[model samples]
Target: MTTWEPKSDLHHYLRVAREALLWKLDGLSEYDIRRPRTPTGTNLLGLIKHVATVESGYFGNVFGRPFAEPLPWLDDDAEPDADLWATADESREEIIGLYHRVWAHADATIDALALDAAGEVPWWPEERRRVTLHRILIHVISETNRHAGHADIVRELLDGAAGLRADHDNLAPGDQAWWEERRLRLEQVAQAAGQSEPRP
Candidate 1:
């Protein structure tokens, strides 16, 4: 919960969150980043790759910075989930480099546009061409944070370790046993109501 207004200057907070999301992959092996974190194999590196490609598209292609890279998933002939997971051949550095490039292009777009500056979304319906930087900023921030939350859960599932970082803030440090009992009570309440468990 932040008290700061998410305005034109809000890029700082959004950028921090985005970086934190990427930092989740730090110290992880190439295998770790590519390993299945979910039934659908939502690995950490894959999520970063997806976000990088998407950020490049929305902020780059939309605004015309146009990041040039050979994205296999972008190919019409490739698997739809290609960007969703890493192949054995892909290295961690390669994916990270791609993400950094995408970010650079995205940042360039942001630097060029004012909050009120208007542009067009080419893929939208014909009547929806005109859009403001404010809208794009909001959309990208929402998209990044949404995906990052997925990353958070996936990372925690990968290891019992959790939090935005791997350290001091991970534990609540207050009546955790009581909290655990309360959680179990909530689970019993839910089970009594015919629910299996809480969703996320």
Candidate 2:
């Protein structure tokens, strides 16, 4: 086997983290991928969807090379929560493909700009004038991983899976009965904690 090297100043950590986030969603069904992990309805597919939009926005649109796509969740008039939970009719293949394309756009942003190349985010305060591709890469990587953790939980709640990274196959070995036992114990503990009152 041969070791790989990064082709540019885009940095290795950023590249690996980006690939890792996309890898986490592999082999999941649309319904399986879209179930809300929290009471707020954060999910795996929706996370990827949001990343695609934001990446394309920051890297493509902000730089004046707008990506060509009809992103409905990004509609400013729509409720913000709508972007966090996917609606029905979002095909797994389509969303995943869009993410792949967004990666291309983000990569181009990296390639075309120097580490110190400056940018101004119009949405931010005017005092914040300059930014760098290197910094943006780091920010997006952190953002992706942050939401990816939420994805991991959503996956576990849907099917009892947990890990910072899972390579397509389910490494969890316990049977459903074992999981049920653990889950019930957790629920009981949570309930007891919720009802406990402060000492007077």
Candidate 3:
């Protein structure tokens, strides 16, 4: 019989979200990974970079255990959203490598502290600045999974590749034709519903 561990379970889910986000970049060319997919300029590589910076801060500085490398992009004087998009000079490997390092640093922090260990969020409002490892873990996991969800859509928009994971897509089993038919059916329903609505 396996004993239930809350921290272990949380860490496992966090790792799952992290891997899913990174998996979105696999098998894509540099341009595809870095090109802006949305009007606001969201991209695969940028998502990874942004999450890395986020983890580095929440897990690193929040716990008084800063990540070794300096992140100039996160500095106040830096251009807004600097961490959200990689420049031409930043290679895919570099961004991915940084994420891996951040994961290691974050994992170390998790291992070192108890779930109830106290920490401070310097950037948060004063009343809410005080936190615990458990709270931070939940926050980081939520943030990572939220961005992973973004990667899912951006990746599908780029290449029609969509899934919760490579191994198990977590989608209904259907061929391309089946999916197209389903989409057309849904579109018809949407149009019908719209027409039935009373617009002022």
> For this target, which candidate reaches the highest TM-score against the unseen true structure?
3
The order by descending lDDT is 3, 1, 2
lDDT for model 3 comes to 0.96
lDDT per residue, candidate 3, 65-181, as tens digits? 999999999777999999999999999999999999999999999999999999999999999999999999999999999999999999999999999998989999999999999
| Ranked candidates, highest TM-score first | 3, 1, 2
Cα displacement (angstroms), candidate 2, residue 146, comes to 0.8
Give the range of the ten consecutive residues with the poorest summed lDDT in model 1. 165-174
Model 2 local distance difference test score:
0.72
Number of backbone clashes in candidate 2: 1
Superposed Cα deviation of residue 19, candidate 2 (Å): 2.7
CA error at residue 190 for candidate 2, angstroms? 9.9
In order, the Cα lDDT scores of the candidates are: 0.77, 0.72, 0.96
| Candidate 1 backbone clash number | 0
How does residue 34 of candidate 2 score in lDDT? 79
Query: How do the residues 1-200 of candidate 1 rate in per-residue lDDT, one tens digit apiece?
Result: 85754564657756876887787887777777788877787889888888887787788667665778768788889888788777788788888888888888777788787878777779788887778777888787888888888888887777644666544445565475876788799998978887655667
The C-alpha RMSD in Å for every predicted model, in order, reads 4.6, 4.4, 0.8
TM-score of each: 0.81, 0.75, 0.98
What C-alpha lDDT, on a 0 to 100 scale, does residue 11 get in candidate 3?
A: 98
